[model samples]
Target: MLKMLLLFLIGAAVSIDLIAGQACQPRSANPGRACKKACTHDAQCRGRLKTCQCDNVCGMSCFNPNLACNDPGPFPNGQISPERGYGQVIRYTCNVGYNLRFGNNRTCQSNKQWSGVQPRCDREYWHFFIILFYMGEDL
Candidate 1:
């Protein structure tokens, strides 16, 4: 019984990574609190990639508990939401009157990075047209 218990404890402590060899996962990850405030480091985060960033919308949190992808930081005139980490669906939005040229929301992949070109916020003429239409403008 003692041996079996010991084995279980050890297994629980470390998780295996299939691609990039073995990586250590902090056994006691974000216990008790559910990221009420901003997380400053890896220990504050939970799951595999363990990324922590303070978001304007969600505060310092691992939206994707399985985190990774170095802080992409804020864009020119836009922001990334839900935190940058694995399994998280990253969404981009521009400031008032600005528009996203082409880039779209993409997932923070398992390899600790975003999958494709991060979008940019620009003042495009088309954006005004779209907004006007939504505001009940006919033309």
Candidate 2:
């Protein structure tokens, strides 16, 4: 009975150690975390937090065209160029009969690097007659 009990305890300890080792192991993939392996293409970095997919490629980050400086930085050698930076200004002009609904001008500040929201062009009521007359010419 004593020998049998000792063998059972040893087996239990080994099993617990194995479980603990597995628990400490790194995960293969996580939504918000970085990639576990190097990727070679964008497809490999498709999850929510884009990571370096290829062996030497850089990861993707948030990018907005309207903002002045939204560059994604450089990629691996011969993979991407780092010379480019993000633009800070975006220009918007209203149509002939439409007036800008938001402020006409916006500026990119030091901390506020994001581009201003696009202003909507509101149609002018006075231009309705002119537009109708122009449409009549096509008929």
In terms of lDDT, the best-performing candidate is 1
lDDT of 2 by residue, 1-139 (tens): 9999999877543322131232122223442333234333345545554432111011222223222344432222212122222333444556566666655444342222433454666667877788888988955
lDDT of 1 by residue, 1-139 (tens): 9999998999665543333344435423433223333454557767665555433223344445544667766688888776665556778889887888667686655445565677888787887688788999555
lDDT of 2: 0.39
Instruction: Give the TM-score of each candidate.
Output: 0.40, 0.27
Which one wins on TM-score?
A: 1
C-alpha lDDT of residue 60 in model 1:
42
lDDT of 2 at 101: 62
